[model samples]
Target chain A: MGRAILLDKVNIPGIRAFEVYREHGGYKPAGKALLGMTPAQVQQEVIKSGLRGRGGAGFPTGLKWSFLDRKSDKPRYLVCNADESEPGTFKDRYLMEKLPHLLIEGLILSSYALGVKTCYIYIRGEFKYLVGILETAIHEAKKNNYLGEKILGTDFSLEIYVHPGAGAYICGEETALLESLEGKRGNPRIKPPFPAYKGLYDCPTVVNNVETLATVTSIISMGGDAYSKLGIGKSTGTKLMSACGNINKPGVYEIEMGLPVEDFIYSEEYCGGIKNDRMLKAVIPGGSSVPILPADLILNTAKGQPRLLTYESLAEGEFISGSMLGSGGFIVFDENACIVRNTWNLTRFYRHESCGQCSPCREGTGWMEKILYRIEHGQGRMSDIDLLVRIAKNIEGNTICPLGDAAAWPVASAIRHFRKEFEEHIK
Target chain B: MLKVTIDNILIEVEEGTTILQAARMIGGKVVPPAMCYYTSLKGSGGKCRSCLVKVAKGSAKDPRPIPKLVASCSTPVQDGMVVENTISAEVQEARKGVVEFLLINHPLDCPVCDQAGECDLQDLSYGFGMEETNTREPRREYPVVDIGPLIKLHMNRCIHCYRCVLAAEQLTKKRAHGMLYRGDTIEISTFIRTAIDSDFSGNMIDVCPVGALTDRSFRFKSRVWFLNPMDAHRECSHCSGKVAAWMFGNEIYRITGRKDTFGELEEFICNECRFEKKDISDWVIEGPRKIKRQSVISGNHYEQMKKGSIIHPIEGTTEPQE
Candidate 1:
């Protein structure tokens, strides 16, 4: 209804099959990219597309790919990060399960653009069934001369493999994912040698999200300039949002960027409003890591401008009043949902998932979880409130990875926005 | 060469030098205390966030300050870079928090621990920690298990520094113990309680920052303050055999690796030298080892005191000495 780019053909009866997907123009983009354009031309097109990463970070996709060490004689790698383990986010699973060829075609085009000879799709261990579906689609593509050595009568050749993780949430981080893929324990490596410089066996590697690669098919089919015209400003093209929690029609919806938050929540085209006619209390617009915004703040900014789903609009105010479009995980909460209890639950998840490589995250996450548990169980003290803030502040930017900040944000933001509820629990 | 300014003191170092190395060249309070970094061990520094410092300027070319405090042990210095260690209030507060995190699960049993006088955690807590702990949660505990006849494993006292694991891996032909499990519950243990019986495995006791890994022979020996550590060495085919013999009235209490100012071993000694050769007749003594003035072991020794200072009687009172 609202300009569906990815899921428009998602509901087709046999779209999972390679033949059915090809009948709807699945591998046309790969053919177009390989036969009609040079690798540099394809890169230039992606740079002009202005497509930011659909992953939580919202970094520019083309810019991240541009940072690869092209001058290095070592072979470059393109790692497709299918390890989507973030809570409240399942759009990558839906897209991969329903239309595997679309993702393969995108990978083919992306691999060609980067001159990559080999690539890997690092999916989560929990998504075991999706591995079979993706592998079947890849087999079908190779049988048709679309993948493997010398595709479409061109010099570009690529190989894509499916690597499953051992079910650790920290492996979703790019470096940790690479570490897990390399058959090591999944602890995140330190920075200064970012994945772009020396990653995946100490070679230049670029890790992109599943949806970020799948969107490349559409960008290649329609030129980059045309794709740039779709969304507002820098957040161009369509985004896949997996809406859950209290919404009536809760599922993955591919909405064009710049859609008003109110219409997207209330309209029949998207969420179909809250269930049981319950009053909306708060919403974690991104994944569980992003800040929880109250009902009023989720729909409009502090200056009363109508909030949209674009990166700039949602982040109009900093973290004081704003949240990110992180992986497009829209979790809604009704009045019955206790902020203290939910914060405790999310903190427990972070605490359980921390790799314990560094100090701040390894201890701070568990410390916050304990404090939140005490508060939720009605055994909290008045001084425990500020202690949580202090602990979260110390952990926010002091660890080896972003997991520390991720573990710190929910507790800090919930206490900042819902301090009254915490006080009531203590009382 | 690169020019770097740390706490307003300018110094030039080679191109590949780290910020921690630069600060160590300047020495004194400017050097950040490192619990996990060993100059000889590779890939051992960044896991322990104890050496975090603030980068006020990225470099001369890109002057944007690094937003987050970086672990100085791993970050390479850029030309015209500016760093802040002891001078930054932000760094001091963050370091305090790091110390608290490292101690939240630590069992404070310094009174009975064998590594009491020379433990790095003791020095770190004294320098950067608060007077009272804010955590009421119970400290994590693990049953004391002996890894071999010579080494004792106290999992409760480990700060997860991975130093022993690195020492065993780098020093021995095959390592038996490594970090098992993860995330606050992580412990340094062998697979299925295998005996760590390598030629160089005893060096794990020397590299341990806390009282986690200790010599079984030296367990419950005289307190380190009462014994005089003498620089001693012996010829051996296995290793450099240089060590410090803790002497108590002509009897050897224990033999340990001769440590430098920052608590790192000058040369890793063999298990034969450390555990088997304990008699004072086995080695030639050089002299009394010069302990750092701040160490608890330096307080009671006579040579460490001023040359002309008069010895006061322990039991008798001298009230009239002006």
Candidate 2:
């Protein structure tokens, strides 16, 4: 329904092959960036594009790149975050599986723009099959002069490597991924000396999401201003949303930023409305980390405004009545779905994924899971509801990383929107 | 210098000083309890959420307060920053919740635990925890693993502070044991059946906040309250010989690294200083009068220590010469 950018040539036959991909305008932008644009000029265009990170946090890509300590003589590095372990989020995996060359082309261009000599794609361990696919794509790209030393006959040389994680969901976190990249345990580092200043091997580094890097190709292809103009406001360009649960068409869909939530869900071209014509109960518009919104809230805001898929629109009410467009992992639930059970499932995921670093996340997630499990299994007291809220409040914002907040938001939002369901489960 | 008002008391500290350090510097009613932070170890902060504090105003460098409560142990104080520890009801409640969660899986076998007198978790729970536990669900249980002849790991009591892990890697540059599983079922275990035979292996007992890792030599030898501790040192080729000798009557039972008033190790003693140097003749032991305060043991032990009930060595025997 929207102008397709990432998925346009994704379904084309032999797109995974470098020859077919180069024939269909794959490495042209990378060639242009390497030959024509200065690294600073490329960074400036990215700043002008206003492309926010597709990696849940929505940080501006150019702003993140600008923070790199350029004066430091340490070798700079670029890490493409392919650890797509977020629940209901498989868009990156699909992008790599189908259009691996696009990601490679984007990685080369990004590496050149950042003045990085080496780049690593830290993919999730469960995506072991994609590692082979990506390695093959890398070999093909290098053979075609799209990657490796002296790419496109330019002075800029970059070597991209595929590093696999040991199936830890916490590795999806950027700092934890960096730690894992160094062959250490996947524990997140503290901020202030952020990754830009001191990252891989204590050097200046930039870690971009797979989708975020892939979009760089388009930004360079059509000038940044043109790409910025495609989407509304600060949320520029197209986004790949992986839709699942109770939907007839449950797959990744790339749409322009300001698509209305209603059309995206009910329209035949998108999710094709709820399955079997059942009433929508709730929707986690983002990944599991963001707040879950009720059907009414997901459709429109508390201010009676139509909720758009853009970052600003979806997050209009903040945590009170609004949810974020985090990772663009859209999950839907029909009226038959139980919020308590759903919340329990998500809490269990978070508890399992917690790296056991921070006390609030490490201990609180386990407590919440056990409590939610007890309540769902009909052995909870009425006080357990208040206790759950109290525990979630204590956990949010108290840990070393966002994992604490990630573990807390779903439980709190579930209780906020579906209190009656939880209450009923208690009786 | 950065001026911060913690609990309405203004204090100035050097830049890049964390709120926990500032609170400790001021030394009043506002000292935040941290379980995982070891001042000597790099990258030791941020793991434990027990030191959560409210910052009303942020520093000049970072103008906005973090959206949520920040760990005082990791958050550096900015110029003109305002922080609240015990004064904030929210922070108190949050700390209480953290203490509760920590105790959820803790076997609470303090009666049998050897580290009862000096355990940081026991002290923190008494200071910040509620009277009763709300969860009726079964607590997590783990089979205790004897790490070696030096340390016994009762993982169920562990809060997963990572101090021992950091001590192993940072102090010894070797890892014998690491976190094995994920999430609630997580446990610290050695890779194979190999013993943690590093020279710094015994320091794991000192770094553990709970009774998870106990000294095998000192196990059931004597209650900590009954032992009289004296600061002692010896000329050794391995490392700094500064240590604390815990004596039962005139016989030395165990030796550990000496700790300052803040309960931080003055120096991370080696296994030789910790285990092999248990004899009284190994080093010159100081007088027992230096033992001013002991970590709280039970209900009445604090009162007993306050009344100076510790037995001093008789006359000239204090100078034990090799």
Candidate 3:
């Protein structure tokens, strides 16, 4: 409805095929990138595009590319993180399922820009059906000479492989994904040897999210400055939001960044308001890992601003009164939804998915889950609330990976905004 | 060389040294206690969050402090780095929380456990743990099993340090055990509970920080406090044979790797020296091993009562010549 780039040709029948996708102008970006511009020039255009990672972190993709260890003799890599296991997020699956060639085209363009001879799409094991679709797309692209040796008759050569993760949520984490790709137990590595310097097989690697890499094709298709002008401020270009949970129109929607939260929810083009015309209770604007915002905070800032779906606007007040536009897993909750039970449910997922690497995440997550279960089952004390807070605080920053903080943030923010709900359960 | 400050004590250490190593250079109370990190073991630290320290100033170039407390055991030092350990209230509170997490599922059976007096977890809990636990849930329980004929495994007391796993991996030709499952449910296992009959399997007991892995030959022989640990060695073809023979008078109670001030082995002894040869005639005794004065093993167990000293008051104290 609003400047659909990544999902522009998604609805076209047979777009999953390379020929149909080529008819719809797929892989043109790859041709434009490899046949004309140098890798640095491609990187500069990305830098100008001001595109942030569509992954929850929202790091500048261009800047992430700049940090790769190009000076090293070891071969570089581009690992696409398709393990979209974040609780409320499934937009990556939609993109790969409906528009597989778009992702492959984007990967080709991205791989060329980073000088990666080989690329891997590390999709989650659960997405086995989507893996078939992607492999088909890759096969088609290779047949058409869009991928494999000497792409589009250029001196540049490339190969793309599909690697499925063995169904672990932590494998969505870049390092854990790399470890899983290496045929080992998926445990995250300590930093200081970040993926940029030492990653898969001890080479400099760039692991971008599935949606992040897919969006690169659109940026290359439209000139970088033109793409940058579409979205407001730093949240440039369009975002593919997979809206779900009690929304009338629960599906992925591509809206330009800076769209008002209210319009995105209530408009016929998007979520089409809450289901059953129910009262909006809250919204987890990002994936479940980000803070859950109450209805008032999700719709408007503390300063009474009409909140937009940009990274800065959503995080305007920084956890106190705002949240992040993480992965754009827009989940809408009506008044009947119990925050306490939902918090406990999400906590259970984190506790189960914890890689058991570091102490705080390993032990503290299970501890929090037990307390939450007690509180939810009506066997809690008033002290347990504060105890959960204390546990969450300790685990927030003291781990080898972001999973600790992810596990902590939901419980902490749920308690912060919905203490009365927990109290009611205790009562 | 890199200049780093820990708890306001400045020291110069070699480049690539960790904050914990730098703190060890200026020893005493300044060294943050490490439960999982063994200087000899590769890829062993960072799992246990006991040695977390705040980096107040990242380095001379980037003076901005790190937002989160980093594990001092793994984080390498930078030039003109400033670290805060004991001095930071936030660090103290975080450490108290870490101890709480470590103990929430750990069983309280120290009195019956063989590694009681020398357990690192015991010392850590005494220092940083709270007076009373806040957890209301039941602690995780696991049945005691034997990984080998000579090594006892108490999974409940295991803190999942991965030390023994590393020891088995690095010290032996083939590792028999490894960590299985994940989260709090994670356990060190030989999969189908097979016996680890490797000659170097005994080193796992030396590397264990808790009573999880105890020498089966020494179990319940005597409390470590009742016996004296004497530094001794024997000529063996398998290992260095340097060990501490815990003896009661002339009777050998147990034989173990000679531990240092930090409770790490001076040299990993062989199983033959540790479990097989326990007789007094097997090795030449090198007198009493110097135990830390603060340790319960050293309590009232004076190895030196010098002649004419106050300890021997019958000889009388000599007045200073005026």
lDDT of 1 by residue, A265-347 (tens): 99998999999999999999989999989999999998899999999888878799998899999999999999999999999
lDDT of 3 at A158: 83
Clashing pairs in 2: none
Better of 1 and 2 by TM-score: 1
- Looking at candidate 2 chain B, the ten consecutive residues that score lowest on lDDT are B299-308
Using DockQ, rank the candidates from best to worst. Answer: 3, 1, 2
**Cα distance off (Å), candidate 1, residue B276:** 0.5
Best by DockQ: 3
How far does residue A408 in candidate 1 sit from its true spot (Å)? 0.2
Interface RMSD for all numbered candidates? 0.9, 1.4, 0.8
Q: How much of the true contact map at the interface does candidate 2 reproduce, as a fraction?
A: 0.76
Chain B TM per candidate, please? Answer: 0.93, 0.90, 0.93
Could you give the CAPRI-style class of model 3? medium
Q: How big is the positional error of residue B195 in model 1, measured in Å on the Cα after superposition?
A: 1.6
Clashing pairs in 3: none
